[model samples]
Target: MGAHRTSLTAQLFRRMPVGRRPQTEGGLKRTIGLVQLVGFGVGATVGTGIFFVLTEAVPVAGPGVVVSFVIAAVTAGLTALCYAELAGSVPVSGSSYSYAYATLGEVVAMVVAACLLLEYGVSASAVAVGWSEYLNQLLDNLFGVRIPHALSYAPEADGVVNLPAMVLVALCAMLLIRGASESATVNTIMVGIKVGVLILFIAIAATGWNSDNLSDFAPFGVAGIQAASATIFFSYIGLDAVSTAGDEVKDPARTMPRAIILSLIIVSTLYVAVAVTAVAAQPWEDFEGQQAGLAQILEDVTGSTWPSTVLAAGAVISIFSITLVVMYGQTRILFTMGRDRMLPPIFARVNPRTLTPIPNTIIVAVVVAVIAGLVPLNWLLDTVSIGTLVAFMVVSLGVIILRRRAPDLERSFKVPLYPVLPLLSIAACLYVISGLALVTWIVFLIWVAVVLAFYFAYGFRRSTLRQDVDDEEVAP
Candidate 1:
């Protein structure tokens, strides 16, 4: 029993071969391009944080919320560098999970995969719930009769079922099932629409700007800024979603890093500008519990219904793309896990016609839809933040490990300052993580423990590396 346990531990730490090209050479299609890849990153990110998070974050940081946006942007920027390097070097699906498997070992990779689930699937559900909120807002603007609270909200939020959120998830699932390139093409157009709408908002909101709003900046101090930044980190979820498409992009080595960097520049610039413009337009104290956030803000500033109606309509259209891209990322991650035998083989099977993982997409959509229907949106956001932050830190660490272990390995892209930048990335992620609530940390710990337990009991015996080890031992 002792020997058996020791051998299992060894197998759990076994690493996949470094520098593995994307399995798309034979499996998933290599059809996605640089432009669509950026759309995936930006689409998954923008609609979630800017649309509704101000209501939650402004209350904590006051007008200092603008600074919080910068804080989160800096953290994400540093981590994005690390991600670009690894995504270029490894060029595989699963994002940070694949990076860890190639460098840190199987156990760490498994933990990262669990984190990816929270980052992709749970965030997808939460964003869909936000979509429902804006969908109601758009309906109220157009027809004056909105969905009833009982039908549109989770039970915890005083509704019996979040029907609209589930419905949105279903729609996105349908798009994903058709094909990867088809979904990416639609997302690219939605991304353009949302970006234009936000630019319109900045222009209009800037006209109403007041200097008084800057007076209360940083009212809650550095701790508050850090805490709000931690929450806002959830906004950057889409940036890494770009990395997860390693298996589907046209040229993984050149396109992966370019898409990640380009998306970061676009997202961070918009995020900071929006934050500054918004705080200048209204008192931070008025942000809490504000529904139809940007739409309501527009009405407050312009004293007209037309601009508010436009914002709501834009949100309704763009948030759909958010759900589609995130669900796409989740399915790809699960498909990679299935290929490695961490999940069932059904998830690994691609449709011959679509060249996409149909079972994986269907399963993700069902689970995310259920979560959207049952859980309050705010309850799940912190979980998403922690999971993505931890995965990012893992990628930063993996860069150092891979460089040391495979010194001569070809890397198309490299972190500019090497150890300094990766170390800063790790420190930035940790600083933000420090601000997470105690319950969030507890939930994260319990979730990781559960995943690790399953690995020892199930993944250990079924791991491909374990099979290889058994074959070596039995050979003459």
Candidate 2:
């Protein structure tokens, strides 16, 4: 009985060895350089919110939405430092999930994985919904036609299934099945398209800027800005997705920190610039009820349909890339879990030809596509924010734990202020979480509970580590 209890405890606390070269042995390919890594971070982080969230955020914070951008950036920056340290120290494929497993324990890893599943899956679905909006805008600008509302939006949103969102998810899954290298290459191109269009809008929109737009900033005060920060916080969700590629990243220690910090700076600067220009182009109140807000702002400023058309096209292209990369992050997390025997083995099976997790990608694609076709955007945004915040907090906690537990572990890069930075990250995440609605918190708790129930019933009992123990005993 004592021996049996010991085996159960071992299974619960098992950790994946840090710095395992799984990809070179039997898994994903290592082909991403610092450039591609940075592109992945920026491409995934910049797309969805900047394009469409203004409509929801601006009225809440007034012109102080720019302040909200800065607040979110600072909060995310603190968390990114913790992520960089873990990625350098652990250097595994599962991002925060893998980090928690190595530094904390198996049960913690499962919980983190649940958080990540929500973050990537719901974010992909939300981005797909945003893509549907921009695609509709582009078509209307180019050819004077639109997808019927019933076919273009979720049923709960007063329409039928969102066809474009599902189609976009399906196409992205096909690209992912081809391989990560191919996906990264395409992501680089999409990043260029995204940046170029934003530059064009800034150049054109600055010509008609109004000083009066700056006068009434923070009309709803600090509380409003904080509220908007909570809403816009999900915009930075993908920055840490860069760290998930530690196994595939080149010279990960140096590359991971550089990519994480660089992507944060790039994404934050662009978000703030876009927000300031948007309000300058039109009054804050006008942002409410606005569809395709950025493009519409451009059209209003330039008095030409062409600039709006260009913005919409850029949004459609970049949001597609964002959805693809985010869904890629989701598949890899599942693949890692499968390899650990916390999930079905098929999820870990790599396609020999493509060197990708084909089964995992297909499963993620189908689930997110169904969600994209059905779930309303507003609910998804908060769900994603809550999940991402919890995951970030876990990574920050893991950093503190590993530092005390294994201080000798070699890390390429370390958080500058050590415990101070990680503690601040935790505090900041909780503060932001406080600003979320009560209903959002309730729903998130229920989701976590459901995931925990599945783990105890299946993952804890059938874990790969437990199977290994049984096999060893039989062999002796």
Best by TM-score: 1
**Per-candidate TM vs. native?**
0.97, 0.96
> Ten residues in a row with the worst lDDT in model 2?
1-10
Q: Which pairs of residues clash in candidate 1, taking residues 3 or more apart in a chain or in different chains?
A: none
Off by over 4 Å in 1: 1-6, 21-26
199-298, model 2: which lDDT tens digit per residue?
A: 8888887887997987899899998998888889988987868977877777787888889888998898888888888888788989887778889888
Considering every candidate listed, which one attains the maximal lDDT? 1
Model 1: ten consecutive residues of lowest lDDT: 1-10
